[model samples]
Target: MIRVLVVDDDYHVAHAHALSVGRMEGFVVVGEAHTAVEAERLVAEASPDLLLLDMYLPDVTGLDLVRRLAAAGRVVPDFLLVTAARDIDSVRAAMQLGAFYYLVKPFSVAALREQLESYRMWAERLQGTPERGRHVDQDVVDSLYSLRGAPVRRTTVVRTLQPTMARVLEIVTAAPEPISAAEVAEVLGASRPTAQRYLATLVKKRLLDLELTYGSTGRPEHRYLPRRS
Candidate 1:
């Protein structure tokens, strides 16, 4: 079972989130915290796998708490930011900090359930991966990262990929062998990081396969190719 820690400044809201979690299969709320201090203590005691966090806390902000936990070398669990903060900056910050998903406040039970269920399935896929010499192909990685988007397309219209993303996918699909980020960067005349980010995005979208090849440097390098059947 996946243990979860729910943190919110409002006791009633925290209880509501906890109750929602309790109804889900394979998940249990280890504890609920109303402050950063309490949250940290519960984290140390519970060592939960997922944290449902609110941005506003009596002490430090939720993001700061996560940063502190990570910096302190404590158990840093996957986070789902649930807050009334709806600013674009906060959303971008959450994505930058790698929150699994950001959920707005006053969400319905079904809306919350969709995200939670997606996370549960994603977590299961991650936990199911082999431990030794484990390397995930494009499909597995896609299923992991593409968790939330699939539902959208099914319920509505297909979303279009951004130009750079589309180009990255096209380039990878046209490659004869697994292509490195350096090659893609050269072709696009973009910085290596930009190319790498695009490649990573493509891999996550299940449009490209990521293969690691180690050379004389003794460091593994990721190369991308079209997904194989």
Candidate 2:
């Protein structure tokens, strides 16, 4: 299992994030820290495999903590920045400092789950690759860097969708407002179940939002909206 340490200035937020991490498969929350000093201490004590770090800390910035650990020759685990820092400089610094992923605040659980799942795939790939006398090709390097971006295309849903999913996506994008599965089926000339399946796939890809609407009748109906990039 991947041991995780959550660090945030707010005690409640730190605890909440830790709980969320604990709920994910192959991950466990090992510790929580509310300050940079405490985070450093916990890093040394807990020896976590990953750090869910907040950029704005009570004592010092998370970037400073990362640099300090590096300067002190302390082993710093892989870090995923979970903060509201949107400045280009801060993002560049985090990327240069080697953060595995940067998650903006006010994000949904699905977004965080996607990042964790992507990280899992990356770790698995790294572990499975055979060592070749320490030499690496450009493709291997590129694959590693790609984990920091969007969800990997190797996911089963994406791989199975093929060319048809692209057309389904186009129809969804062309709609002016949130559209229902029945509407999509009519537009694509496909069965409702088929359209619903494609819509669910897009939602899982984080490209669409699924909203529930009550019709004052039976169960709530799901409406799909293209997510703003």
Candidate 3:
């Protein structure tokens, strides 16, 4: 399971977010922190695989904590910023400071799951596998750096959606029933519209089958299932 730490000054938010992440498959919440100082201590001791951080803390900025970790030669886990603040400047700074993704407040659990899965895939690739491509080169391994070590994007929507889309193709193809966008959103913590957009892309790619389902109230809901060769 992917070990995670949720850090926030607010007690409720910290626990709630941790619980939300724990509900996802192949994930476990290893710790929670209500202050930057405590967070640093816990991260060092627990050695989490992922850290969900809040921007504002009782003591210092989250970015400062990350910087401190790097300076102290501690293990730098992949970071996902979960904050209410949407300041462009702060967002840019955090990304530049090497946050993997920044999740805005009120995001769905699906978004969180998507990001976690992305991290998992990235980690697995780095851990190496026997069946890896024979032609794989340094650049292929380098691209995986963007997954944990480098900060390429700010918004969780973009950071999470791309990997989630790839996984959705897998899920839909394996599911026995047609999956609706709402189901996809539920699994990934994304908006239904966002899920639908990705689903549409897969359909365009001929990787999914799109159909319309009628609700009991006679409403039409679009559904997608995997297309088999």
Instruction: Name the top TM-score candidate.
Output: 2
How close to the true structure is residue 194 of candidate 3, measured as C-alpha lDDT?
Answer: 86
- Window of ten residues with lowest summed lDDT in model 1: 149-158
- Badly placed stretches (over 4 Å) of model 2 are 152-229
**Residue 111 miss distance in model 1 (angstroms):** 0.9
TM-score of each: 0.64, 0.66, 0.61
lDDT for position 47 in model 3: 88
Q: For candidate 3, write residues 1-229 as lDDT tens digits.
A: 8899999999998888988888765789999998889998999899898889999998998888888899999888878898988999989998798777888888887677667766766766666633655566778667677566333232322333457788777667677899888898888788888888889877864567888989899999888887654
**Mind giving the per-residue lDDT tens digits that candidate 1 earns over 1-229?**
9999999999999999999999886799999999999999999999999999999999999999999999999879999999999999999999988898988887888777777777876776687777858888888777678874234332121134677877877787788889999999988889999999988866755567888999999999999988773
- Residue pairs whose backbone atoms clash in candidate 3: 109-189, 110-188, 110-189, 111-188, 111-189
1-229, model 2: which lDDT tens digit per residue?
8889999999999998888888776888989999999999999999998889999998999999999999999998888999999999999999999998899998988788778777776776576566866777889778766766456554433443458776787788899988999999999999999999988888866668889988969689899887765
- RMSD of candidate 1 to the truth, in angstroms, is 17.1
Q: Candidate 1 — which pairs collide?
A: none
What value does the lDDT take at residue 2 in candidate 1?
90
Q: Estimate the TM-score for candidate 2.
A: 0.66
By summed lDDT, which 10 consecutive residues of candidate 3 come out lowest? Answer: 149-158
